[model samples]
Target chain A: MNNWKIFSNGLFKENPVFVLLLGMCPTLGVTTSAINGLGMGLATTFVLLLSNVTISLVSNLIPDKIRIPGYIVIIATVVTILEICMAAYLPALHEALGIFIPLIVVNCIVLGRAEAFAAKNTPLSSLLDGLGMGLGFTLGLALLGSTREILGSGKLFNATLYDENYGILVFVLAPGAFIALGYLIAIINKIKKSL
Target chain B: MEKRLESNFKNMVLVLCAITLFSSLSVASINALTAEKLNEVRLQNQLKAIRDVLPAFDNNPMEESDTLITPDGGTLVLFPASREGERVGTAVKSYSNNGYSGPIWLMIGFTPDGAVYNYTVLEHKETPGLGSKMSTWFARGNKGDITGQIPGSKGLRARKDGGEIDAITAATVSSRAFLDAVNRASGALSGNADAVSGATGLEASPGATPVEQPDATTGATPVEEPDASSGATRVDDPSRTDTSLPDTTHLSPARHE
Candidate 1:
């Protein structure tokens, strides 16, 4: 496989969020604003990259039947490290992410990449896959966050675009998440079909 | 194809244990490295909260903070702000557990003469558009503004309860909880020792009134003695107090720091 293709596959062709439909919990929960979505995506990306690299390094040592448990232990440890470090250094972002930070331990995207790609690939390829997938996921979240924030709060990246009072409140709530995500997926599907 | 290592019990246990051990070591080291910085960040946030509610003071309010036992068994941390050796006022960290989302914490400021200076919501989980309005809803211009009002002369309950304060649009429960916290702080500052009597119905008054409400506002007096006096309640233990508390306070302008 071409190195570039392996790296860029996650951006569009094999996008984890829109295409693969991985990591839906954070996708709907924290993408209420552009900043939050981007923040969460980046945090997840960091975890994905680290876990992918580490899992690839140790894949040969683990038996197939116990692979899932091994992957989970590694991912949980990385997540705990990330959580503590963020709480200590990036207190603002840590608080902003709140419960979602710890929830990343169970984020299927991290574990999925570890099993599907990292377990079978070399360290360098696994790293690129993680990066590509992370970027794709981040972009999807940003798109959703911007859509929700714009319609629901009349703001972009915390900047006000219009009278916030006139915003459609539903876009920022639970139902709004489903509505926006459904429309976003529909649009992406149309784009892919035309391409 | 050569059969890879079997998923035998021994192999699985060994692999899992190895991963757990490595992860544990890595996490422990990272935690050790970041723990101090996290504490510093938390303290800075607290300092910022205290500064937001209280007026300017020449002395360092952080060092001057003292713990006071409220009439209702809650321990309040009072930060005294002073200028030129004269006591300006005090900010009290108070909590009301009656919030719709459980406990709501507030940092309330009181002038020397018993008027509200300002207040800031420290922590809360109230509904966003409704109860979360407590953040700035009680400012000087908001409909439920509590700034400059004397909770002593005018009662602290919402108008729904026959008091003068206004409630949030759709968050009466949160509004009541907020007022209860503010009133508790005000009661602590009234220096009547039996100040909790005024804050009844909102709090759980267990049994006998035990602790003397030490007037920390009389001068730069520390709350150590009153904290010791309230040792019987177990609620006022200095070690067990919610380390970061909020409320209004009695202003004593003495330079203890």
Candidate 2:
């Protein structure tokens, strides 16, 4: 595949959240607000990018039987580094993300890319793939979070658009996450079909 | 495609060991780099909470803080703030074990007469969107506003428990726990240590006498110790009375660096 094609594949055609439907745990858990969604997306993106490059570089050295465990260790280490950096610099966002940051180690997208794309591809292509996929995930989460925030709280990114009392409360709850995700998938699917 | 190594037992073990070793090394180095900054961040957050809960004061409440033993064997730390020479308010780091999910920590400030000035949730594992609302649920203008209210003076219980304050929607357990912490903080601040036990409703004595209510308005004196002289019930060790102030030098230059 061409360089741009490899990079842009994750953005639309193979988007992690909307199209491929990977990493649903954080997708549904932290998208309570637009900023939270964005933060989680970026954190995942950082892990995906770093792990992809590291795995691609070291894929040749790893034996096939232990690759899964190998990939997980790399991903977890990257996540721990991210967690420490976030706690030190962005304390508020760190607190807000809370348990979700550590949970990123288990996010299938990081491992999925390492197994499917990064392990087979060159380090540069893996880097681009990770970036594209990470951005795609970020985009999906931010959109979902914004939709829920607006519908549930009459606010977008915490900027009040109208009185919150008039807003639908269910959209900000767990059921709302499912409902919003379902409709969003439908909408994205429709757009993809039309294109 | 690049040729891969065979999945032999020795290869698998060696590769996995190398990977784990590198991962741990990286994690350890990163942790080392960020450990100091993390500690500073936590200290800054605590200082900010103390400021938010208490009224304006010039003296370092942290420096003049006191630790008291609660009736239930927990230690409550009091940061008594003073404006110029007169006492302003005392911020208590109080906790409750009755939250819906787990324990809830709160920094509650009280005026000299024991009315709540303001409060901030220090830590909690409460359910998000419901119990987590406790952070803002009892702030000044919110529906469950407990500001300016005395804990033992009247009903501090949730409306479900026949109190005046409105509980957060679908979060009665969290609200009750919050009130319990506030009441305990108040009890400790007023030197009415028996009131703390009564608030928990575990042992409600019909006529629980107030333990020596120390006048908090006095200049820079530690508030009445919660029967610290009575070695039997005191939880905090005498050697470290100001244990709440953890290594101030580490956090002093938090802003500068």
Candidate 3:
């Protein structure tokens, strides 16, 4: 019960994107298209999960002096795996997301997990913590992406609901990402406040 | 006591070695596992882009003679294109440094005689509603018929800005930069086809990675994208990247870089 409560905190109480504000690079960049946001999010999530598990397993084995380097090597290795997989299977999405895929290595969320949660927690708990944080981060990105896409594109996942020809263009650009992120943060805050 | 300290140090060294060895080994293993799939996917992407241009052509980048150059100035790649001997078209990844937002990487396509056939925006940091829309309807409509021979000179610019091409609404900067890159790439091939027939040439260079896509195929015809009437968001372009992330300072036109 106690473990579940701790794991649940990351999902809502301390969500990485809304609550903690980690992994802003990808959150801001890839959320232009909802699908791109989802793909990039999953890629980050996959990396966060795998790196957390691996880091937890070898936490004691790594010397304190060299742990930071060790974590980076592990995270980079995971990111490369995610990148290659995306390139191979989802080429279009891969193209859409572009360098943000490589930029996953430097995302603070993954590194924060390794240091704060994985370094001290049991392997199972570490995995859960990483997964929760990843899901939370992904949720934020998807929400922002969908909001922006609907406004900017008049559609969701490329399916035209209203009329894209009449859609607002600001919702699709870099500026859109910022505007959407702000509104999203505000909404999440509202909900938090209400609760 | 001294002997014990020596044993502890040796143990620490061994663990460090183990971590290094295993990490490299895992990364190498994952890389090897995904390399082939990555190549196959990239080939398919090249094909998909070509289909968007030459819809009638069924073959892809894999079937054509691989002549695309790598970004790092290493080996030249040749796609098995063309029928029996004659080349139909070739796509070259290129870049431009004059986007409305910033630099953009693009892929330019041309025929065997070195005439531009099509192009796509590979990657960029352009303004989304304004400059970034160059990749959508505008480029698609414009990509099919935007080519013309300048006889002795390479001409590439938006028609609005005194060039042969039309610019997208509020996206003139991207249009100019994109067309310029394509013109330069096609012009380069035109210049060197006689000197280097079989050799692959880079549009940008091997050094410029993360190349932006610029899909401007029509030299004469123009593509129309969606409208931006409802978008009043005033997020300002930071005009800086890498070394120059703009400071927010909590002002209007929230920094969107």
The CA lDDT of each predicted structure is 0.77, 0.81, 0.63
Judged by TM-score relative to the true structure, which candidate is superior, 1 or 3?
Answer: 1
The RMSD of every model to the true structure, in order and in angstroms, is: 9.1, 10.0, 12.3
Candidate 3 structure quality by residue, lDDT tens digits, A64-180: 766787788889888877777777777777777888988989999899999988988778888888888888888888888889889997889878889767888878867778888
lDDT of 2 by residue, A1-195 (tens): 999999999999999989899999999999999999999999999999999999999999999989999999999999999999999999989989999999999999999999999999999999999999999999999999999999988889879999977878788888899999999999988987898
Candidate 1 ranges with C-alpha deviation above 4 Å = B1-4, B68-75, B159-166, B192-257
- After TM-score superposition, what is the CA distance of residue B139 in candidate 1 from its true location, in Å? 2.6
> Chain B alone, model 1: TM-score?
0.73
Model 3 chain A: worst 10 consecutive residues (lDDT sum)? A1-10
| Cα error of candidate 1 at position A134, Å | 1.5
TM-score of each predicted structure versus truth: 0.82, 0.84, 0.71
Q: How high is the lDDT of residue B67 in model 3?
A: 51
Query: For each candidate, what's the DockQ?
Result: 0.52, 0.79, 0.29
* Candidate ranking (lDDT, best to worst): 2, 1, 3
Docking class of 2: medium
Clashes of each: 14, 0, 46
The positional error of residue B105 in candidate 1, measured at the CA in angstroms, is 2.4
What TM-score, to 2 decimal places, does chain A of model 3 have?
0.94
